[model samples]
Target: MSYFDLSKFPPSSAASDDGSVSSLLSISPRSSRSIILDQSFFDAEDPSPSPRGLAEPPPQRSLPAINDALYSVQVNNRRRSTNSNTTTSVSSNYDSDSSGRSGRRPIKTGEMGTSSERESDGEVRYQEKKSKPKPKKKVSVVISGGDKVKRNGGIRMAPLNVPIKRRLQTAAVLLHGFTIPLYTSLFWFLLAIPLTWPILIPYLIYCLFSEAHFDGSAPRRRSHFLRSLPVWRLYTGYFPLKLHATTSLDPAKNYIFTYHPHGIISHGAFGHFCTENTTGFEGLFPGITNTLLTLDSNFRVPFYRDFLMFMGLASVSRRSCEALLRGEAAQPPPTWSAWKPWTWWRLVFLLPIFHPAPHYTAPTGGGRAITIVLGGARESLEAIPGRMALVVKRRRGVLRIAIRENAGIVPVLSFGENELYDQMVPTGGGMIEKLQMFVKSVAGFTVPLFHARGVFNYDVGLLPYRKEVNTVVGRPVFPKAQMESPRDGDLDEFQERYLAELRRLWDEHKDVYAKGRLPGKEGEMVFVG
Candidate 1:
């Protein structure tokens, strides 16, 4: 619709030769006439024509001023359209036009190109704006595979298609876990049978009065056959345990091997020391007879006691430890003649009947070594997966024994021992912990509420997860000579040196062995009394 009334506002006297009003308006301001419209035209869409005096020619301006004003008006109009719901003021546009005529406009994001581009077609340049591309942010990604997996919150169910050999390995460990119960049940079952009383009664009497367990010249019932069983290899394979000795132990010298972080079951110590098939302890340190020491109270159990002695395990009692160490200096155990070729069939049956008494078959000679779990029962309470805490700060009995015997103290640290079980440990000084402590004070051992994988499922059972356990034996710390009466100061000095060696051993191999440790402070090696 036409808003201007052309009838009243005729062409000005200074119009261009073409007689066009637009041509006159486009002239340089210096030679241009002022064009004013009626006030009514701006107030309404249709307005009455103004008086003829409004058509009179006005003052002129230069061409440069005219061009600058046009540019300023165009820029102002563009800004006004971009901003929503805003009124444009003609006075402000004229003020800006009058202020600048030579300076270039500042560049902005998503704006038109350079001044050269603006000098061409303003409409085309405004349409061809350079849109600044938004910067892309980087993201980190993690990948999971067969060996390791991101734990989704749910029960970890085991796959059905497991190999038969792996299943057998799991079964072997399962048997070991149930040894005490299984043997005790068997003993009671046999006792229930009245016909077996004659043999069983004598065995019970012998077990009760047997100095053979504590006197420790050499374990009479320590069966080399049982220690070197193929089942031990399968048990080791369940968690795929390994042993690494930093240096060879001398055959002529006695050594005290102290194990750290007494895990719930101490599976690493059992698999490494008590069994010959796991890491070939004998092959690693030949001529040294190592006896794994356990609590003396364990000897009270009937069948389990015999089973432990069969695996070359001894009591950790003062008498037993001293006896084993003293036996080393005395005569070695008696040896039997080599088996003749005719006994090949009996050997194939895997029986312990022969009592193959080789000179080095038992903990005999001066080359005897005793392995003690230095942390004992208290440390078992801290057996959380991917974490370790040793109760060795004030426990100096084993160290005192080492000093008195003039034995080398071998520091053994087994990584992943605590990863065998998931335990529900109560917070320190809590009611539950107080109750646990009370039980421990009376029973000599604290019961850890723990669990792990099952026979069929990967979660919710007693079987330990398929984790790798690496037991690294550090260099032995020994005094200059034996001290039958070591002073408190001397004991302190020796213990500091021993503790230093233990910390060094941990620092050296923690990265490789404890890669899967829990995060933050809980994952660290804590020492407690």
Candidate 2:
């Protein structure tokens, strides 16, 4: 996988929403002490005297100037009282610059006064439209170690004035969003109690025989209704998730979406693909049934297995991959899956039966999509917020599969995935790293040492940090026609193209989608084996 490091970079210097402004802001803890700014600090009023030999430090290093800037919004806002802290707080620096945007032009006083009116009988009446002065730019300043966050406004959606009931409902939604993953184990653990054994035994018996563990195509599992529920919308919306498409896909084709840098969990993939009515995936790209693929191990989880199926999730395994993409229970070529032995009867059964997905069902189905979290567990170790690192150079499994299935590859990047949690990456080759590696070898996944703001506080919780996550879906890269035994070099070539597209997407939109991700340097997407 790739590598990541924690940044000492502060949030105040982050980019403005829409990237219209690039001012560096320093947000310190809210001090009760009144900030003092000397008149000489103003660059326009009194330029500081230059030293004989040494150059001056930049304006950023000057505390008085920072204070003056932090408190200068009072005059700009036309507040009568500059003494009131509310008028000049640092948060006001984040206000939306709507007047500067196109189309919605604010009226200017000069233009208003220029309009003249004529009256009958040589009596002329002048008419002037009153116009409000444009508001200054504002940005939300999240001060560390203090609850006194001055969120005056910038770069985020405007908060709604909801009733108390709605506020409580939102809280409930957040709580549910966070707890749903853990609830699976919790459900079984409760059922394990002696009094509940009767119900638990039958469920266990049913689960033991269920093909839901291996076959995602099972009719009962993929419930379109459950995927359409309001709860799923709340779950996805808790991140206030956004789904963007670089371009629409053709309904006649199948696609393979490879999601990068699997942050803690591929929550973005789930929010974007697994639910349709909520994230509006269907409305955006109609006629495509998208399956968000995951490690088969998740299908082994109690209660959670069923939920994954209901959400149209399937195993990201060799047999499962071939079946979903090609619409047949075809065992991947021996080169793809070295272990599974093949039989001719299985091939024979599929010769006359399959249609390729009709609504896009196999045989008559519209075409289908299979999304894989390309970076998997190893990459999660590198999932530090604000840094973009990917483990894609050696990620040829999905590419090979896509080539074999003739599925177009679509690169999906979640701009704020890593921001959901702060991870603790043990030093390379250190004991902790070795232990994590050992666990992954035996158990198929490694746990990253990670944490996020709690439900109660902003620093210790299982709930994902309440940062906006924008997932941009790029145009598809159509793989060469079906190759039963695709060449390794050809697969690598496709991967290079895929990686290039991902980098292109990042390079193009980082300013907007991942603004303030890295300061001083442009954010880089690294590819380590």
Candidate 3:
């Protein structure tokens, strides 16, 4: 998320592997020419003067000087001979300086001085300036384009010489990736401890019955402190997720963000929406309080459930969606007895079930947003390493919700999301695919058999491989007007426009962000039902 600024570091005190003195010098490119100067440039009096007493612009103010040895090192590295074109040519007003007039003039380029002219007092001053060692400063200059000295090609393991800070960053991401399993194990382990049952049982009851997720009020349990943790920066640096907003979103209007191709875990979605500091969600879309929507079943897990809620994630059900967009409270949880299972069956199923609603409420939209991964778990099955496909064609539910709520629909395309993991994708209508669909029908979510790099090793584990994920937020497509009962034609028209915008976003950024994408059809973005 942050670039390493070479300016902050001290100059190297030793020689580099290439047999060149690694000392940093104040070299800057001006007019496509590398201007290398010695101690004469920073002296009390300028040795070189401007022609005809006119002030020529100074070489763009250089970085702080470090070592005198770098002067020789830089000159040798360029491998250019001192001449009319390469060396620093000066225009001196030696006669004017001798007559007591100010001779301080700017540096210029031209022919070299005569041997007798070079041996003048100015030359003696230059010799004195070089002989006396100038104090080294604790500053450096960043190369114009990039300062990354060395890079290796192909897949390689983390080098042993990796910095401690980078290692800690990897650790932070590893901890986050195992959050669900870690919390699950911790929850069961706590249950085993009879002494902690007094605390754990009540917490378990609260996690199971709390209607906090459904109410759609500002999440009281959502810990801003936790979400703003420094660890999220490392998590982001793991894949180094970058968020791009194509157009500024209006805070007065509500938005429904449709995230595509739920890659493995939808890490892009979580980083961009769930946490503010990760992708600078707050700064990017100012005044908009966006809540990431996930499967309601996730709240069924014990400790892991609490973790999701704390991250400001809400249920992706009709009631929660409606409540959030309306900026109003949802219908209060209905009270029912355990003995009368028949009476409370609807209450249990209706509250969390993702049923499409035809009824529309009076628009009371504000600076609120609900981010839904359009592809969901079904599309996750198609998440291969280098391919980009989405189960998006049939998913018009978000559009309908946006129409009813009078909210803008923002299509988000995440490049390199599918490259995070390798999955065992079944052939079309194959037995494996059929079995996966059957499970999804029964449990509402299906798991894709996937694997990636390990903790310490770069092979065989659940940790998503280190890849760059760029999540681009396209312009919001607002409804023409609020409609109590939107027509099918209207919904289709909106969907068409939304899909077109999404495709355009892909085409605009695919080459830059998806260069690693597979060749031909496998790499092309496709829509499926």
- TM-score for each prediction? 0.66, 0.61, 0.63
Error of 2 at 357 (Å): 15
lDDT per residue (tens digit) for residues 48-121 in model 3: 33312333443333333333333443454344324435333222212123345433322222322443342231
For every model shown, the clashing-pair count is 4, 26, 0
lDDT for residue 181 in candidate 1, whole number 0-100: 94
lDDT of each: 0.70, 0.61, 0.67
Model 3 CA deviation exceeding 4 Å by range: 1-157, 329-365, 428-430
Cα lDDT of model 2 overall?
0.61
Over the stretch 1-529, how does candidate 1's per-residue lDDT look in tens digits? 1122333233332222333222123222332222222223233333333423244454334445544655665676567656755342222211111354321122242454553444343321112223468896533223211422223345554455667788799899999999989989999998999987866776677577666566775444467777777899999987888899888888888899999879888998898889885787878888887788998778889878767877878888998899888773244543433442223322333554335334444444468788999888889998887887888878888878988988999999999899878899888589889988898898788788899887866667998878888999999899866789888888888999999999998889989999988888888887867
> What ordering of candidates by TM-score runs from best to worst?
1, 3, 2
State in Å the error of residue 29, model 1.
Answer: 88
Q: On a 0 to 1 TM-score scale, where does candidate 1 land against the true structure? A: 0.66
- Which candidate model has the greater lDDT, 2 or 3? 3
lDDT of 2 at 488: 75
